[model samples]
Target: MQHKVIIAGGGTGGHIFPAIAIANALKKIAPEIEILFVGARGKMEMEKVPQAGYKIEGLDIAAFNRSNMLKNLTLPFKIIKSLNQASSIIKRFQPNAVVGVGGYASFPMLWKAQRKGIPTLIQEQNSFAGKANKQLGRRANRICVAYDGMEKFFPSDKLILTGNPVRSSITQSAVTRQEALMHFGLQDGKKTVFAFGGSLGAKSISEALRNILPQFVEKDVQLIWQTGKLYHDTAKAAAVPYASHVKVFDFINLMDFAYKASDVVISRAGAMTIAEECLVKKPVIFVPYPYAAEDHQTFNAQALVSKKAGLLIKDSEVGKELGTTLFSLLQNKALIDQLEQNIEKLGNSNADMVIAKEVVKLMG
Candidate 1:
């Protein structure tokens, strides 16, 4: 019989893309392998996994809400219900091993697998391990991570610095500047500053950009900004006067193109975005989301800043200083080149394959 593996997690592209990367690596090594994806029923993974050509099952699960205490009142029931559902799915799939990428849904799935005596693997993308990953790491056969000194988070003996798994298309792509500008329908031969707030968008970043559209046009710098879903229209409306030099959207499906065209990038410091930036060697100014678990986004950005590989600006500071900071960086070619070299040094294109190899070996 071929090897069977179950990959768990995904509510965001951060988790889903990496999960899919590892699954693809495993298949590349052993083509006949059977893979099953376990995710939360109503999450994005259900749609994304099918699109990626994988079979998946969703458990009814919900995370403890920190914002509204009342929302967490029913969390206990959801946890129990999800755990029971996970057990049934595990029994039916009969995977030789389980791989977890952190999200609320992964907890029930990985926890049940460990109890059943199946070898489990964890790919923790953040600098600070999440509550789910930390709890599961205790018994996890292997813990794959992107950053160093994770010994404090997981057992030193189990740590494997496999880096974060990136999407296969992204890993193999080389989207050039001309091509990327064309994709955005913006002209070439101008400095491009790429700004995005992730898939949902960042209101502060959007507002900052909205207030400074004239500054970009005045400087002759072309802009490709992703305004998140909420702020997309506002950003577009603000950029309408400079529409020839500015392109605003809610989301970017062709990220490779965006990365290729930009000279400097302004973004929210999410774990996956940091990884992708390193891969593309773009100089970035990160505004860490203040609300992420344990303030991990700042840790992610700070680690790069410590290396002098990127810049950091707080989310609150975006409203006050985003334009000034970007203008300063835009004018300094030496600084941008230095940042490019330093950040590119940290890229790890094969992390997905490395983690997959380690997991398969653990299973055997």
Candidate 2:
């Protein structure tokens, strides 16, 4: 009998990519197994999942508004409606198990699966447990976490410490520095700096880049700047004069090449990004997004900072500190080497496959 599994949740690439990783592992283990994704209606998963060649269902759901309290008045209704939609989807799919990677639509769907007496697993990617995942932990048959010290969040016995799964392109990587530089059209002799502000883009980071572009060009530094989709055009226009020293894009699907080409990386401290940085063993200056769940991005960066694995500069402090932070790291080869060595200690690029194997084991 073919086992049907549902992987749910996704607002950002962090959640969506992990779901894809598990799905790929599951298919490798059992080619005949069935898989489906249930994501928030308007989220990126709607596009990303299908592009990855998986069937997906979208629910009309949204997270309770944290920025504007009044907007949460509709949340109760949205939750009830989403629950009804989730139950219907599960009834039709009849999944053997459901795996949640953490996002808005995951709560109702996984809760319904638990009520039906079906097994459910959760992959929590953050150092800090999300409120929804914390609530789900009590009933979850398995909890796969990417960090240690998660005993405070979930039952220690139920927790499986699998590191986060990075994209396959990066995990099984052989992209040489020369090839990566050629792909970016950058000269081999020049130092390259990588920059990105998550998938949605960070306004402050983009602004800081504008003020610092001339400086980078003057220093003979090359850049692989991914200026999140929202600010791509603006960043491009501002960075026009320095095009000789820059490669700007909204996204880079070929991350293995990007990481290999760069000498230093300036980035946001999302779980997935941090995992990838560790896997690549690159020096980084992390600009943690202050509003991330529980300010978890700060915690993620702090973990690196404490270990001297990476430098941390908060989002709120970016305007004044970001440029200086990147400047120091780019110029200091010893500091860069120290960070690369320390961060590499935390890399577990195979966690996706490990997590999948464990989830399948529990299903039996």
Candidate 3:
């Protein structure tokens, strides 16, 4: 019999990628399994999930606006509407399990599933739990987490540390440094820095890179930078003088290549990014997004920094600290090697399969 499942989440790549990884793992284990995705109506997942070859249902839900309190006025009504839509979808699809990966859309679907006595799972990617996941945990059959010490938020018996599920291409990357360098049109022997501040370009990281553009050229370092859409034009203009030493993109679809070419990485400390960095075994400098819910990004980075597996800089310190720190790390071969070996130890390459097996077991 075909097992049917619904995976829900995505306001960012951190959630969407893991949700897709889980779906892919399920398909691999049970080829006849039917999977569906649920996400916010106009969010990235609505577009990305279909591209991953799965059908998705979009809800009319909106997250509570943290920056603008007035925008949350209609949040209750929207939640009610979404729950109704979720009920209709659940009735029609008859999924054996519903998995929430932590997004506004997931809450309603998972809540409805739990109320209806269907198996429900919540995947919490960050070290700090989100409010929705915390509340949903009361009824969720399984709470899959990436970090330890999450029992403070969920029942210990319900929690499972499966790590964050990363895209298979990243976990099983086979591209060599030479091939990756050639793909970016960079020289093989040059020290290369790959920097990205998540799917959306971080203003601070981009601005800092803009100021340090000339220094990268002077130091004979090559760069593969993903500036996200917001900083693409500015980053392009800033790189013109050092064009030969830099390759800049709004988004790098070929992350496996980027990871392979990089000697060091400068990145936002989102859970998925940390997981990928660990798997790639590269020395990383993390600039935690200070605005993340509960400032979880800092918690994520600190876990590695505490173990000498990664380095951390505050989001506020990026301008004064990022360039010099990154340059110094590039020159420190012994430190870099130590960080690589230590971080590689933290990676769970089979997290997707582990989560998939557990999902199946819980559903049964």
Top lDDT model: 3
**Candidate with best TM-score:** 1
Q: Write one digit per residue (lDDT tens) for candidate 3, span 1-364.
A: 7789999878888899999999999999988999999999999999899899999989999988899999999998999999999999999999999999988789999999999999998999998998899999999999999888999999999999999999988877788889999999999889999999988888899898888998988999999999999889988988998999989999988899999999999999999999999899999999999999889999999989989999999999999998889999999999999999999998999889988998899778
The predicted structure with the larger lDDT, 1 or 2, is 1
- Between the candidate structures 2 and 3, which one is better when assessed by TM-score? 3
For each of the candidates, the C-alpha root-mean-square deviation to the true structure, in angstroms, is: 0.9, 1.4, 1.1
Candidate 3: stretches off by over 4 Å: none
User: What is the C-alpha lDDT profile of model 2 across 177-234, one tens digit per residue?
Assistant: 9999999888998989988888777887878887789988888999899988888999
Could you tell which candidate, 2 or 3, scores higher by lDDT? 3
Better of 1 and 3 by TM-score: 1
For residues 1-364, what per-residue lDDT tens digits would candidate 1 score against the true structure?
7789999999899999999999999999999999999999899999999999999899888777888999888889999999999899888888899999988789998999999999999999999888888989999999999999899989999999988887867778877789889999988899999999888888888888888999888999999999888777777788889998899888999888899999999988888999899999999999999999999999999999999999999988888998999999999989999999999998999998999899889778
Which portions of model 2 show Cα errors greater than 4 Å?
none
TM-score of each: 0.98, 0.96, 0.98
